[model samples]
Target: MSTPGQPKDPAAYAGPLSGRRAQAARNDHAILSAARTVFLQNPHAPVAAVATAAGVGISALYRRYPGKEQLLQKLCADGLRTFIAVAERHSDAQPDPFTALKEFVRGIVDADVHALTVKLAGTFTPTPELGELSARAGTLAQEIFNRAFEAGALRADADANDIPMVFEQLTAIRLRDEARTAALRHRYLDVLMDGLRSSQGAEALSAPPPSSQELGERWIAPDAIMD
Candidate 1:
């Protein structure tokens, strides 16, 4: 005990901390991989069940992923990477950027059947992790829009900076129940694309005169006043 001045046990200091960090990383990976399987098979499974499936204790799971929102946020972000890879393949193969952009949008819309998106949109508030996912998604969407813009697929007057934000809003709406079931979402998306098209093309896709004042009010702003 009198020899305490000689650099007391470095191994004692570093061992547990290093092991804990490694274990945490391993546990996080195992849990997420297990969650992916459980989520796919039973999207509604309880969090405790996910922890059980991962072969980790509930406390360990919580230590790695604090709550349901965090878990789902990570899941969606992971899914987006896979989804984007698949979408890029299709988008890159198309000859026309306009067709490619439309197909890319369609592919994402059709592929939203993954339960994580459904659960996150319906249940979770936007936490920091979710916000981070959105930020990354914005970057990916910008790349897609930039490619389209370079190909002259978007109107020259429109701001390329606005596309990702606009796309996010539209995608959210498309994921809603009423919006998802009907062909109405596809029609609405076409109208949105038309709005961003060159003047001649926009005029061509313009629908027949509004059938009623209600329809007119919905399509054309009642706030629009003539001088």
Candidate 2:
């Protein structure tokens, strides 16, 4: 069965696999799922922690991912895919702009996208593939925000560039129980959503909306990104 951090298509990996390779695929799934948990809890964690968490030998973990940087890249690439999928799904299918935006926000939160951001940002220099996917995700997110803004749903003061920072703000609600942590994120997200809606008497933002370049600068050109 599919689990968090596992590739979406389990059966069709790198063409058909021999029995031994099939076992390796299964081990890969376990390794990714465990790594997600271990690293999210602690980004600076040693590689052995992932091996122990995955219930695999250290050698097996290394064989699958040459190093922690590779592992971080894979995890983030998976998260960006999820983020893009949710944005794409809601970008056109929903008729109500605000509702669509809310659902998209909820989907990403459910996917634990913010947790990945809170835990893993800057942990590795992203490969070119990851960088491309990140840019795609950002474009989709902006499209979603623009739709809401054009429809007079989202506040005029906030723009798509604010989305990442907004999600990062919500990532502060960590708790011992992951479920509770998720619940709290949604709870605050709902509050933030209310503030984001266009409404009378909502003061003009004291500061100018952040430029895309400002946010883009955070992810070094030498690398890749979030939200």
Q: Which segments of model 1 are wrong by more than 4 Å?
A: 1-66, 113-140, 172-182, 200-227
Model 1 C-alpha lDDT per residue in residues 39-82, reported as the tens digit of each score? 65665678898899879999999887888768866777666665
Cα-based lDDT for every prediction: 0.58, 0.79
Runs of candidate 2 with Cα error greater than 4 angstroms are: 1-18, 221-227
Which candidate achieves the best TM-score against the true structure? 2
Clashes of each: 0, 0
**Against the correct fold, how does model 1 do in TM-score?**
0.47
Q: Which tens-of-lDDT digit does each residue in 122-159 have in candidate 2? A: 56777899889988998888888888999999787877
Score candidate 2 by TM-score against the native: 0.85
Highest-scoring model, lDDT? 2
